[model samples]
Target: MRRRPQKPRPTGASQYRINHQIRIPQIRVIGPEGDQLGIMSPDEARDIAVEAGLDLVEVAPTAKPPVCRIMDYGKFRYEQSKKVSSARSARVEIKTLRMRPKTDTHDMETITRKARSFLEKGDKVRFVMRLRGREQAHISLWITKLNAMVETLNDIATVIQTPRIEGRMITATIEPNNSSSQSSSSSSSSAPSTTTSSSSS
Candidate 1:
């Protein structure tokens, strides 16, 4: 079924002060381009913001010297809007790979390759190793395979979940090591797709 589109997020032109109300102490104000305006009282800070045709936004209320920025509330909000949108667009979805207990060595290798591909794309990999019949008695085998698979991916991914036997299946999850690793992984995943597309074209 087609889902209804979510409501658009409020941008710069929309309300900048959502439900937040802040009472700042001494403020070290900064100009629009980040030039310092020294320290001032709250009223003086507001006056400065008013004169500059901007908002007295408390940027570093927790700093030793509270910091405020004189900015167009709407424009500041717009940039934040763009950041959120960019982040959402850049997000990679998690992918799952499942296998039966009797899967062949070659098949396991293929599944490992696919999982590595998924991890390289910055997607979390859910490895579900299913056990059937008396095969459940050999849960140790599945754990061993899971550990080996995770070890193989140590350079690209880290195990997020340890092997846990759940009913008829043992499952684990793996994620990228860090932000740089994530980027590398995504680019690696995209290379194959780009190649396939170029060949098709």
Candidate 2:
């Protein structure tokens, strides 16, 4: 009699061991809802995962006997990717928007729009109001103008550094309001049904 060929195991995302890829003799299993299911063989655990229509993922491989969880592997990987992308976008980098004291209304609007874009992406923004020659005499006025310029982003950011004159420059820094953004990101991800019912006109 001829022996049947063995199926190949999954071969991507080495950061995790999933399904038949888990070759450990014994492992600790966690249920779909995170309840501990005690020690079991990988084959037994894989059986449960298959019945539940989920993947057995080795989450804590360093732990004694190792720990595995039954979950939707595709969803888990997608959320992890989203978190990484969010982290990179939210990394605090100071972006400077420079304008002279004599910078006009139209130019100021353009600057504020650019600043708003930076703040939305969770970056720190520094507004620089440069003063030279006689423009230095109106430092107070320029500082007020700078403050007003940043007020446009009041809903999305907090002023970290108030506008202050430093030699020939007036500068202020504002950072994104993380609490609001994080709350939105953490909210339930279930998208609403978009199917519409037809009605008689």
Cα RMSD (Å) between model 2 and the true structure?
12.7
lDDT, candidate 2, 50-129, per-residue tens:
78878889899999999999887877878988988876654445677888877888888888888888778666788877
Off by over 4 Å in 1: 1-85, 89-92, 179-201
lDDT of 1 by residue, 105-153 (tens): 7877888888778767666777787777898888898789778877888
Each prediction's total of clashing residue pairs, residues at least 3 apart in sequence or on different chains, is: 1, 0
Q: What is the C-alpha lDDT of each candidate?
A: 0.67, 0.76
Which candidate ranks first by lDDT, i.e. highest? 2
How far residue 34's Cα lies from its native spot in candidate 2, in Å, is 3.4
